[model samples]
Target chain A: MNILEIKDLHVSVGGEQILKGLNLSVEQGSVHAIMGPNGSGKSTLANVLAGKPGYVIDRGEIHFDGDLLNDVDPEVRARAGLFLAFQYPVEIPGVSNMEFLKAAVDSLAAARGGEQTTAVEFVKSVRKIATALDLNPEFLKRGVNEGFSGGERKRNEILQLLLLNPRLAVLDETDSGLDIDAMQTVADGINRFRDAHNCVLLITHYQRLLNHVVPDVVHVLSDGVIVKSGEKDLAVTLEERGYAWLTD
Target chain B: MADRLEDSFAESLIANLDSSSGSWLAVEEIIDRLKSSLTPAATKESWKYTPLRDFLVGFTGAAAVTPDITGVNQPGLTMSALSAAGEYARGPAALANTGPLPLADAALLCAGDAVHIKVSGEIAQPLEISYGEGVQVPIVITLEDNASLQLIERNNAVEFCNHSLFVELNRGSRLNHARSALDSNCCDWGLTQVRLLETTDYRLQQYHTGARKRRAETLILLDGRGARAELTGAYVVESNSHLDQQFIVEHRSPDTFSRQTFHGIGAGKGTIVFNGRIHIHPDSPGSDASLVNKNLALHPEATINTKPELEIYTDDVKCAHGATVGQLAEDSIFYLRSRGLSRDDARTLLCRAFLKSCIEGVLAEEVTEALLRNLTGP
Candidate 1:
């Protein structure tokens, strides 16, 4: 069964159409990669799926776990087991990363009729994740993404995904700012979070990430719609051909 | 209302005066100054932004009535007294009062008498003071020679009250004063004067919330060489309240430095005013000072008036001032809301962040918590 389905999705910003009649679907326990060049609506698709404001949805029907997803808020979508690892996470000065993550986790848990985690319990869980991501305990004390290196920020995003344990994770260019070692670490984290009940939509422009955590399906998005869909080989083909054949 | 208030004020003033007392002489001097230098129609540049006329009209009277202090809450410091006792012991005794200042209009002849704090050496203890309601109570704090102390003062009253604080800092001393006003019923007016000896340093952080009418004025004299002063203030005014802060820092000696930053958030029909002035004498070479005023109008009818002035006489000195008034950043709000916080929650979060710098400077944790609770409303 499809866990998420987007049909005829069209989006616009400031009267400029971006996504036009995009169609895609993903089943549970699968990893999907959407590869496209810059301004090919890859990031726009991620943002629109996450329900970010200011994007005019002219024609679309998005179903997440069999429920209409367009009208819900980004936060509500998060509570409903959807997570977005932003391409460029914002730095919130004076708000510690630990405090923010705990609040987000507690808010989601509360919505799911689960008891809020105690600080001690949260610290224990966070320490484990931080260790896995090669993050120091001191990093949690610092303000959210403030003064953090680009690699550290990407690791922090994975840390949130690990702690929140959402059913569907949409990563927008998570590997964009990572070094080779950091890229391996991020891929490792993605692989660790994969399970039969969960899915991931990895949005990227490079095929380097696909080499590590191979995608179950690769889709090419151009001009707001998915022009081609195939297994992992398509990414290599696009990487080698460089969209020259596809345009022709 | 003005005539009745003036008449009542005169009667109360007379009732509090002891014709033969030496302490009463200061009261007379203040009154004389008010009459001559600060008249009902006085055009003091500092009072231009505020409706001084309306505040004076409501001044009504200054009475000597003993107030009830049983329910007055004391401001708590971030550090524990036991942990800070050694530091506290060596601090300026006159500035170390840990409890709330005696309520204005309270009988301060006995236990409530002003404590003299003399800072003579280096001390790390942070002192906190809270104020309660009523008409006439005086706190006299004196800082002396090469002394250093961090003092946090909080004014939180549940009912109408009037309070006055008189402070003097002498030569080479360092004083960090932090104050917070968090109650709605408080109609408070505070005047602080600091005199710096050679190379003395002073910093002030003031914050207020939920006041009917509140005004705070700070006057600093950089009398000795190398004296420096820094002032930072923020306020969140709601309802129909009016809040104003006026500051004057005079560079009387060469090599003096001073800077001021004031911010405010006005909602509902509330009004806020910030007037900051820096004066550098003709002979005060190597003097540097600047003032910045920023405000956020959270409502259409809310008003904010900011005037930052610099009077520089020495060509060698650097001085500048700037002011900005606008609403909260829309992108910040959207960012928070995107994180799952409701719009109201997002606004509160950003507001808290805006005021956090001032609140954190307050070394006392309990006082900070109380102020945050009050400003954020429950």
Candidate 2:
């Protein structure tokens, strides 16, 4: 079953065309890698999927779990199980990480007509994920993304990804600013999160992260549209030869 | 013109004064200063952003004085009536001549005596003082050597009120002061002056929801070596409200330290003003002072004016000052929305975070609710 379907999606920002006539589809229970050079609209695609404002959807349609997503609010899309790990996570001081996580979880639960998690249960679950990601529990008391190191910010993003447990997770360059150890920890988290019930949309410029999670499908995006699609071997070829050969 | 109003106000005060009102020794000094010092006009640099005309209009009528007290009896604390406190009231009474303090002078002139509080040892319980209902309150506090106290002041009355507070922290003494003003349709005027001795510590946490018109002036003097002062304030201005705050910290002794941080929000067609000034004297060589004032404008029609000024006479001191006026970051709002929070929830969260640093202590929860009430639009 197709979890996400983008049919000939055309997106523009500030009256300038960025994503022109783009088409893509991700099946359920599979990982897909999107690789492109600079200015190839990789982040734009992730933002458009999250329903961020300022992007004019000139034309096309978006379907998520049989629901039209083009007109959906960002929070509505989020409650329906779509997540976007920001390339530059915002630093919100004074709002503790624990409080933010609790609000998010409760909002999602309320939207699905489920009871809110108790304090003890919520803390136990958060601690479990924090320990798995090697994150200190003390960090949960501090402001969200406040004074976090580059590697720590990436790990924090992955922490949310696993804890939220969304149907489709869009990792937008999450592995860009991480060291080898941090990268391995994040990849391990992704590996543990993928199961028969969910899918992952991995957006990146390097093939290093794919070495750990190992995408099932690889697609090359150029000038706002997918230029080629193949199996996982395509990522390795692009890493060796670069996009210059394919673009020319 | 403000000059005409000042003359009439001063005349009315003198005509209404009772023979008992002049019992205090500081009354003569206050009266002299009231006549000599002109009411603040918009042309003056210190009163540039504030509209004194609106403030003077509230004082045109007769004054009704209501006196009351609460939460003063506790261990290691002593309270005395101002008339019986004797020479102790002399110091605070002289403070009326410090500047063009019309409101402070008016409060002290009408007030025959004030509440005098003296702390000898560390007190665990906080002291509460309430002011409002056309009442003018003058308070004097003294912390002996190594003594400590927590003071909380609040006013919820619907009528205009004036408050004057004077604090003296002796050697090695400490004081934690907090105040909240959360009425929607009232007028308030307050003046706070503190003197810190050697190695003494003083901290103030002030929270407010703008009234019909409000003005607060605070002065902290580090008079002894190794003295320290910390001041934090947060306010929210809504429809038909006007708030003006002036904070001045002076380092008069060597090796003194002071920090001032304030955050405010403008959510209606109101006006908000903040002026923070730090002065380092020539003899104060090792002074370290920092001031920060940040403001957020939730509505374009609201007016926010902030200025941070620094004056250093010595070259061997560290001083940093900054002021900013802006709107909430769109990126932050979108980030929160993407995490499953609605737009309104995201705004409330961000607004609360923006003011979290300045609003704290026993009344944090209550003050937070009041400040965010009109801010989070319906």
Candidate 3:
């Protein structure tokens, strides 16, 4: 069975139509990339799939692991193994990152009807993950993403991705604003998250990230529809020709 | 409605204290205050936001607390009763006795004998003045030159209590004062007044989990140069309970500093009110003061009134204050929920975090955790 299937998915924001009857599918253990120019509804696709607020779905069907997710709340969708790494992750003032991770991990575990991780074991596990992402252990004590630089915020998202270990990860422009070294580290984290039973969806405007983490399939989204789907060469073609040729 | 309750409440409390051993002079000030308390409605400027007429039904038929605190194990400490030992009676205190508020006078009239605490040198274990049972009690504390001490005051589970705490710190003296009060169907009033001397530091922290009707007031006077005061308070009121916190800080001398951070949360039909006033007197050119009051109303039916009142008599002082009344941030909540917390769990986490930073310098971890648990629980 496909890990994610979107059929006739029409989504809008602020009464403006963005994703107009978009359709796509991702099989288990496969990595799919959606590359489009600015405002071609790349982030909107990730948001709609993660159940973000303020998005009006005119018509659509979203199935994750054979379960219909259109009516589910954002948190419920998250517990059901759908994760979205936001392009601009929010900075919460008082909620410490470690505290947030503990609560988040616990929530996911509880939703899965599994035993909660002990605080000691969880701390040990998260510290290892934080170190792998080159994050200061002290950063875990600070407010979530507060006072973090652009690169730090992006890396922090990767830390969550590694810690949560969701079955389907939707990364929205995770490569933007990252330096080469940071981009390589994030790619490594994403590569680490790839598993046989999980699916990975990458949303980007450039093909640079695709070089580090190759995509099994690439989809070109324009005006809310997947106009084209191809193998890795399609990304190189778009990077060389730009998005105008496809629209024209 | 409040006027009638005030009159009757004052009458019965006064009668009870008159039956005690206290001199008429002590109770006379109370009589004067009670007479003036009825006319000025809670709708007046200072008490405008507080729904006291509807919530503050004065306590009736409650007894006065006999001063039982004595001979604390800590060194450089002593205790006495104001009514029994006239020398221990510290008169003309500030706060509720400041010409307008009547609760302090009623407390003085009702208290069998207010506790008088004296510290002369470096004190170890905190001197505690607790109303462990159901009674109204008043306490007066004086720290001599170069003396330092801590006071852990616990007043909870009382039917009705109107108490006053007076603290005077001499040159280079310091005091750490902490109080915890969490009870219901209880009309509780706590008024604390502090006078700081040269180079003295006074820190007071009060935590409450609500009551039927409650008001916790802290008034600090930085009377000498280089004196500093840090005051923080947090309260949680739910159901039909009411919680009011008033912080009055005055920099009376140059180079003095005062800071106050307050947090209050309300759920159900409860009302939480915070009134923080900072007065930088003239000639105190080098004074620095700040007052911040933040409130969170958990349920739609809950209400919060937060006001930071600044009265500056000089242009040379640096003063800042801010008050914000908001519920849990939608984005913050969503962020937490997305991580795995249910909506309710996310709300609890935010509420707990709100109360954590506000209750500072509390030595007893269990006390602080207990208060946190009470507030975060449904």
lDDT of 3 by residue, B1-378 (tens): 545665566665555443445653545655665666644534456566554443334444355665445347567887766664222223323222332255555555556466777889998776766665444566778899999887888775466666677788999999988888877667776777888989999888878877777777777888999999998877777878878787788888999999898877875678787888888888898999998888887778888878788888987889999999888888777767667677878877788778777866755464566655655456
Worst 10 residues of 2 chain A by lDDT: A150-159
The DockQ scores of all candidates, in the order shown, are 0.28, 0.79, 0.66
Ordering by TM-score: 2, 3, 1
- Number of the top-ranking candidate, with lDDT as the measure: 2
Question: What is the CAPRI rating of model 1's predicted complex?
Answer: acceptable
Worst 10 residues of 3 chain A by lDDT: A86-95
Where is model 3 more than 4 Å wrong at Cα? A113-115, A118-120, B1-18, B24-44, B50-63, B67-71, B83-101, B132-135, B367-378
Estimate the TM-score for candidate 3: 0.91
Please list the C-alpha lDDT of all candidates, in the order they appear: 0.70, 0.84, 0.78
Which runs in model 2 stand beyond 4 Å of their true positions?
B17-21, B25-29, B40-43, B60-67, B83-100
Residue-level error in angstroms, candidate 2, position B177 = 0.7
- Model 2 lDDT tens row, B264-353: 999888999888889898889999999999999988899988889888898799999999999999998998888899998999999999
Ranking of models by DockQ: 2, 3, 1
lDDT of 2 at B316: 90
Candidate 3 local lDDT, A137-242, one digit each (tens) = 8898998898999999999999999999998999999999999999999999999999888989999988999999999999999888998999999999998898
